[model samples]
Target: MDWEVHQNPERLVKTFPFANFREALAFAHRVGELAEAKGHHPRLTVEWGRVTVEWWTHSAGGITEKDREMARLTDLLLG
Candidate 1:
């Protein structure tokens, strides 16, 4: 229901589940395209039935509104 916040290097992470690898991979690709368009990329781990996305701001030195917005946009990808 919410993102997993990480410490050390601050980040907002979430996991999207799917029935198969193709679905997850497709979702990851969409995120990649979105990242390219926004010029803000996240760490994406595409597995057999899920994709984990982590967003954070490097220049800002922490999690910022941009990271949250990217996570929001990522949710929009499903809608």
Candidate 2:
């Protein structure tokens, strides 16, 4: 749970480090698949060696239990 909590629009954020751009992009694709399966989406920023994921419920206007669950699943992706 290394996620950062942000207010104003409330969300859970985490940045995962990778060895290279290819690895980072692959991770982002995996996350997209997960989001599609769960019907929940997150903001993903894929960079050269890092991918930042932000999870929030847009309709709810903040973080929710689903967001927390998604964050956990996202962590498991790295493991």
Candidate 3:
């Protein structure tokens, strides 16, 4: 997993579409579980039919491997 692969200007940003808010929230919950398990959390934004996830090591002021790993797992959940 490489955080550099995600090209958002703010950094560590990934977005996905869902059928509805319910699905988006469900996916967010799954992300929450993973974050808790690994002790790494992300900033999440849920809209009508989409979710935007941002992950970065705040203390370090940049993205890290953990963010990429979580992004992959989040993609898996969406799949």
* Cα-based lDDT for every prediction: 0.94, 0.97, 0.77
Give the lDDT of residue 4 in candidate 2. 100
Q: List the pairs of residues colliding in candidate 1.
A: none
Model 1 residue runs over 4 Å out of place are none
**Roughly what TM-score does model 1 have, to 2 decimal places?**
0.94
Tell me how far the alpha carbon of residue 36 in candidate 2 is from the true structure, in angstroms, after superposition: 0.4
Give the candidates in order of lDDT, highest first.
2, 1, 3
lDDT of 1: 0.94
TM-score, candidate 3, is: 0.81
Task: Rank by TM-score, highest first.
Answer: 2, 1, 3
Q: Give per-residue CA lDDT, model 1, range 1-79, as digits (tens).
A: 3889998799999999999999999999999999999999999999999999999999987799999999999999987
lDDT of 3 by residue, 1-79 (tens): 4333354434577777889999988888888898998899988998878888888787767677777777788778756
TM-score for candidate 2, please give it. 0.96
Q: Please name the candidate that would achieve the greatest lDDT relative to the true structure.
A: 2
Provide the TM-score for each candidate, comma-separated: 0.94, 0.96, 0.81
Most accurate candidate by TM-score: 2
